[model samples]
Target: MSAAIFHNPLLNNGPDPWIVKQSDGFYYMMVTAGRHLALRRSRTITGLADEEPKVIWAPSSPGPYSHNLWAPELHEIDGTKYIYYTANDGGGDDTRRVCVLQLSGTDPMQDEWIFKGAVNAEHPGLDGTVLPHKGELYFFYSGYGHFPDYGSAIYAARMANPWTLVGPNVLITAPTADWEKQGGMAINEGPAFLRRFGRIFLIFSASATWSDDYCLGLTSISESADLLDASAWDKHPGPVFAQYPEHGVYAPGHNSFTISPDGQEDWIVYHAYDYSEVDQKRSESRPRSTRVQRFGWTDKGMPDFAKPMALDTPLNRPSGEV
Candidate 1:
């Protein structure tokens, strides 16, 4: 039971981080590294530091996605590989949109990634992620609302295929709580899905990332209910994960989850901002790092996230891994 306990900030300056266990038996990580897209692969999450990031794709021509790339996520659907990300040219929100890249080769690093165009949200949007439940594929993402203060809100629709949108964008969660409004933006974005106990929980980050108050909130829908119906969702009252300023961990949101190698334990991977830093402007300049912690379920089968663990304390790795 005595496994190695690694430090927090697993990879410094890594924000909007996402890790997926693919068919290759390796963990693939994607994060916002400024303007271009990059990927890191490792047998274990702790081993990620041993490997240098492989720069997979950078736009060669100048256009809508030529600059400011953020929140890149990778997925393999059917037999093809796809990547979802947000970017824009210098022309402001008009150019900012959710775009995708498709790969022909197995290895994303060595493959030729073809531009697949934007998700066609009809409004300014970002953080596009896909989830397939039952027999339908749904595309979930964050979009700019009509109100200026509604910097972003989570929305989704059934997808006809990987890159094609089928239904109208249904608004899932808008920032109605005061905790969600920070740094002038009432935001709810960075959605990740966890399906269990006959329910689908859409866990997402809320508030501005630039602010330390940035955290996570949860909304769920019954598996038997109509997922496309906005009225079917049950919104949690507050954030499931938030700042632990006493432990020097702040803005602990924007998360993704994966099961253990033996499929016995569930682990959640996320990035957290430093708490001691006072300068909000310069604080964001410091790189956010990726961390993982074990999470469990309540008696009622809801996710028991508890509290954000202390930063400096060492914790054991997930159940069964070398």
Candidate 2:
């Protein structure tokens, strides 16, 4: 018997890749759709691109939440499913904020998607994600502000509900290191949550997305600690996963975690560029493609995301892939 094999760059032009496996035994994925929200479902991670993405939702009017859509993340809280994504008018970065959409039925493809409105972060931000901890909902986002430099930073605020944010936005992390402050501006965004062995980890991206230096960073706190307490969180000094230029992989960030089909392995889905797109002058226009690879945990309980694999490498498909 032979193992199934797949290649990297699963979908060209796919950026900010996000994948979440539901109880239906299918993987649902969404990326930066630019003008609307869409989802792709597949039985195996690598099979996602084979299915035509279903446009589940789009703005009904030309308003604040009508344009520049990016990074749609699906989450189920309580019993309702919601999609949190970044959007804005044509007004640019300061106008960008997180918006929500609710599913009217179990089937995201068949159900109606209703606009729930913009989250009240009180400050403009992007790449919003939810963390339901200790029976409460907390929202994590990249709030636009000055951390001594004009750019984005990570913030956490308790959500009054799935679509509304309440209380003060607690600063979780900001770009300070040279690596994080590359490509003209500092940034720390695209937050995702992971739990393992009594620790809750927050994985995020740093450095400007257009820069070859863009990469992933991680922070964590004890499962029992006060999640909102800034002091309780420990930030890893360097990027946990970064570019492998020698492998023709660059700017690998905006990642999401999901388990292999049979629940036997952990996989990371993200987007990056090929060697040709390494030119910083034209990097912003270069299309990023979604890629996935399985990862492991360390003896210290930290996720070990090795360097991004080369674009042409043929690797065995995730364990139990259908």
Candidate 3:
């Protein structure tokens, strides 16, 4: 199978992309901003760029998360599909809150999303990712405050139910290293954890999300170790993926991974900026745009994200007739 090439800013004004492969044989994706939560679906993974995303959920009142809906993710657990996202009530950064909603139909497009309320936790949270590990459901998100410096850290907890946390949140990773210190902010946000080749790998977006230095960092835990243990996970010491020097793509982070139609290939869907000067502040130019690329496994069985390809280039499709 040949690799496919897509460009930065795949969507006009989208950011914080979250993608899920639905049982109905379509790729459903969502992003932050614009009146409501935008939903996109496509039969082919690469074809998503051409599909018109619809607002599945919107804010009715003026509040912190009312206008700025960010990082919306869809997960199907125990025969029910749930949309997890972040928003603010008063239309500012401080009011940003993580919330969840229930989708009515089996198919994401035809379904009606109902507000399910916020997931209970200690501090304010954003970028919620729901992952099931070993028969137990786990929620991974970014936590603020606790650290006197006001840096964001990755935290996780068991889920008693799909929309609720079972216990206190556990701190998994923080911005203690140089790689995570960029854009003048000690930050660790946008966490996505996966197990491959007997190792539990947690990939996170690091650096100041608003700066061009925004990149991805990796941490790992042995298959035999407890994932909730902070000591069990080892930080990679550097970024797994970041901006492309020659391609002019910058601030590439907050990504989601999914399999192709045949279910044999791995692809990453993320947002990036075409211009280097666009800071993290929300704007038309800095809108989180979606892009996709083939993910290769290294000799050690970990993801080898050497360099992201240009979004406008065309490459070979994954194996299996697509």
Candidate 4:
């Protein structure tokens, strides 16, 4: 697997990537635009580049969730597949909210997305992720406007049902530390959880989303510890992954992890810019182009994610395949 083969953006103009490994040997991915939910699937991670994504769902009315769709994640729970996403009212920032939709068929490609209505949270939240930990299920999302500073914070709550939180939101991670203070202000968003090696780790994107300094941060609670207790987990002082000075990939954020076809290799899929010359606040040019790279552990067993590969690197198929 040459680096050149893995360098191309898997999906151009796509932002806030959410990925899931289906049982039928394919990877299903979705991201946000203002109007509709775009979806794509492929056998190989790189194969998603050539695959044409479709608008699987869209706003049927001009209401609170009619526009500004962001960070759409697909989850399979109790034999049903659901997509959790963030949306704002009528494409306005003031009405931003989180909602879930149910997919009818077993195959995500069949296009049977049915609106499941909104998931009630204690406050306005975005980037919702459904993760099962231990014998319980939890809903992790980014808290927006709940704090006085208006900075994004990561929160969690037990899920009594797949679409509803059972209690008040528990604050997990915030941007008070120095490492999280880069890019003008400290903002922590995009919460994704992974239970690996008997530890429950929460991976969140940090820094100002529009800046080249945007990157990932991590925190974890031991399997034996109470996840709802903020003091039980430890937060890494630095980023887990971020922009590469030499590669020129900028503002890499809002990512999800997936396993290879053989389930032996880990890959991080996210959105980034091709050049660093563009102004950080330019929304038009900051399209969330998709990219993927191998992820693993360091010598101390913490996550070791290398600099993102250039947009044209060639890589082999995941291990144990052609």
Q: Point to the candidate with the largest lDDT.
A: 2
Clashes of each: 1, 0, 14, 16
Our tally of clashes for model 2 stands at: 0
Candidate 4: where are CA atoms >4 Å away?
Answer: 1-4, 91-94, 277-283
What's the lDDT for all of these models? 0.84, 0.88, 0.78, 0.80
The residue-by-residue lDDT of candidate 2 on 1-322, one tens digit each, is: 2558888878987999999988777889999989889999998888897899999988878998889999999888877889999999979788999999999998888899888889999679899999988989999999998456849999999988899878899998889888898888899999988999999999999998888889999999998998889999999999999988789888899999999888889998999888544465455566888999889999988999888999888878988876
Per residue, candidate 1 scores C-alpha lDDT tens digits across 1-322 of 3456666667787888888888887888888986789998988876776688988888898887888898999898886889999998867766788898999788888878998888878568888999888888889999887866578889888898888898698988999899899767799999999999999999999988867788999999999988879999999999888888777788888898877766888888888876534655455557788888889999998898777777677887766668
* Model 2 stretches with alpha carbons more than 4 Å out: 1-3, 276-285
- Sorted by lDDT (best first), the order is 2, 1, 4, 3
- RMSD (Cα, Å) of candidate 4? 2.4
- How well is each residue in 1-322 modelled by candidate 3, as lDDT tens digits? 2435433445766678877788777788787765577788887766777898787778877755576677888888888988888876654444566798987877667778888788875668688888787889888888785677647888988888877898778998888877788888988889886679999888999989877889999999887877688788888988899999687678889988888788788888788877775434456644657777778898988898778777666655644425
lDDT of 4 by residue, 119-146 (tens): 7777676888887777788888887755
- Which window of ten consecutive residues has the lowest lDDT sum in model 1? 275-284
Arranged by TM-score with the best first, the candidates are 2, 1, 4, 3
Of candidate 4, the 10-residue stretch with the lowest lDDT total is 1-10
Better of 1 and 2 by lDDT: 2
Error of 2 at 53 (Å): 0.7
Q: Tell me the TM-score of each prediction against the true structure.
A: 0.95, 0.96, 0.91, 0.92
Name the candidate, 3 or 4, with the larger TM-score value.
4
Please give the distance, in angstroms, between residue 223's alpha carbon in candidate 3 and its true position after superposition: 3.3
Number of the top candidate by TM-score?
2
